[model samples]
Target: MRKITAGVFISLDGVVEAPDQWHFPYFSDEMGAAVDATLGAADTVLFGRKTYDSFAGAWPEREAAGEEDAGFAKKLGDARKIVVSTRKLEFTWRNSEQLQGDFVEAVTALKNEPGGNIALSGSISVVRQLLAAGLLDELQLLVHPIAVRKGMRLFDEGDTAVPLRLLSSETFQTGVLNLIYAPAEPAADAGYEDAKAHLPQS
Candidate 1:
């Protein structure tokens, strides 16, 4: 089975939208280095349509400046990109295939396919689905301190994003806090007062 990793830049309130407005300035050397490090290690990429559009516009041109991450960009351009979507899109990026069937089924099949690790970026909707289905293996959450009163979210399911257990956390030089999490099992008697009252003896 393949390991699926998600790299996200989010806010304290779970906001993962438009970090470019206040964070992730790829022009800086520090940010460049971080991207190089992350991209250099990953062999496969998974993303939602929104992220696919963003990358399709930017990454193709990133190598023009001759940065160290340029090679990674080229690799990204060539690597297999699995795009999860319902609506039809005319994306023409090389080495990409669309996943249009059942969400959970498609991802599970991908994970079972013989391949290296997969990395997801800016696919908040897809992340929500993965979390709902318990398919996410790891999360690289770049948590920024600023609060955006409104925007997209990291893992907001239609009803609610499932609870997560913070496995580890670290601070970057840019003050972006990275929080790692694994899906936590829900309480047996959750949301039921009567059930909680009759909980098993410890």
Candidate 2:
């Protein structure tokens, strides 16, 4: 089965929105390599509507301009992209498809298909939904040092608590924390609240 891995850039305060505002200052060769490695591992890419629109608008233009990361842009342009949307969308990006129907069911079916893995980036709502549905296999958070006090947090208020187990962690010279986690199995004797309480905070 194909694994569904989510890669997100988040602030120290858990804010995942508008990473462009604060994410670049800390970008380094190491960070670039990490991103390259993540992309290399995935054969397919999944996106929420907003992320799809943003990427389709920028990557194609970057590829056309022959930018510094033109190779990366080309890879993104060529990869099979599955955009989750309820309404019909004009997908001008190459190798892209729209997924409509029950969100969890579609994603579950995708996960069961034969593929390397499905990589998800910058799709907050989609990530939350997948986590809640127990469809996410791995979560990789690039935690920056700065905190943007006001923005959409990764785990917002009233969201259901999902337990996770830390699989690995790395600290970069730029102080970016690359934390990897997997969904934790609920203990046989533990209640939902107990299981959540034992999980680490992101």
Candidate 3:
């Protein structure tokens, strides 16, 4: 069973949206390398429709030729992606599929499938849903030092603190901190879900 890793590049105030604003500068190399590590370990990427659309438009251009391209964005175009969007959008990337129905059903089925870890990018809506469904296995946070006064946040209005144990923590030379967390395994519960649950038939 592959882990479901939630990867995020957030600010001091937990903003995960565009960081290229006049005041909020983009992430540095240290942050990039840490995020790249998580992307490298994943065989699949999962996102909501909004994130998929945002990424799809930019990743292809970056993959081919872009000055701001990173290692992860390049691999993103080629990795297996599952987009859970209900807005009736289309997918253009190869090995990409749209999950249109119930978010829980679609995400649960994806989790039960046989594959490597499912990495999540910037999809706060989807992340909240997944978090509520208790499907995320690991969390990789690349925390930058700057704080944006206003922007889209990663947490939902109803979201509360979920207990997590830090598996690893590292700080890079560029002042970015890498924090890897795993959900707290209950004393009696065998991990979170039954590992034997088979994937829903395609």
Candidate number with greatest lDDT: 2
Candidate 3 TM-score versus the reference:
0.79
lDDT of 2 by residue, 1-202 (tens): 8888899999999999989889999999888887777765678999999999999989999999996988889989878999988789887899999986899888888988887878999899889889989899999999999989989999977745677999999899999998989999764575788779778899
Model 1 regions lying over 4 Å from their true place: 25-39, 155-161, 187-202
TM-score of 1: 0.80
Residue-wise C-alpha lDDT for candidate 1, range 6-80, written one tens digit per residue: 778777787888888867542355545545445445677888888898998887787655696577678888788
Question: Given candidate 2, what's the lDDT at residue 89?
Answer: 84
TM-score of every prediction relative to native: 0.80, 0.89, 0.79
Tell me how far candidate 2 lies from the true structure as C-alpha RMSD in angstroms.
4.9
Better of 1 and 2 by lDDT: 2
Off by over 4 Å in 2: 186-202
Give all candidates' CA lDDT scores: 0.75, 0.88, 0.75
lDDT of 3 by residue, 1-202 (tens): 5678888877888888875452225466766666677766678888877777777888887777756675556678778988876566566777788775787777778778898778887677777777778888878887777887688887756646666789999887666778988877444555436654654655
Give the lDDT ranking, best first.
2, 1, 3
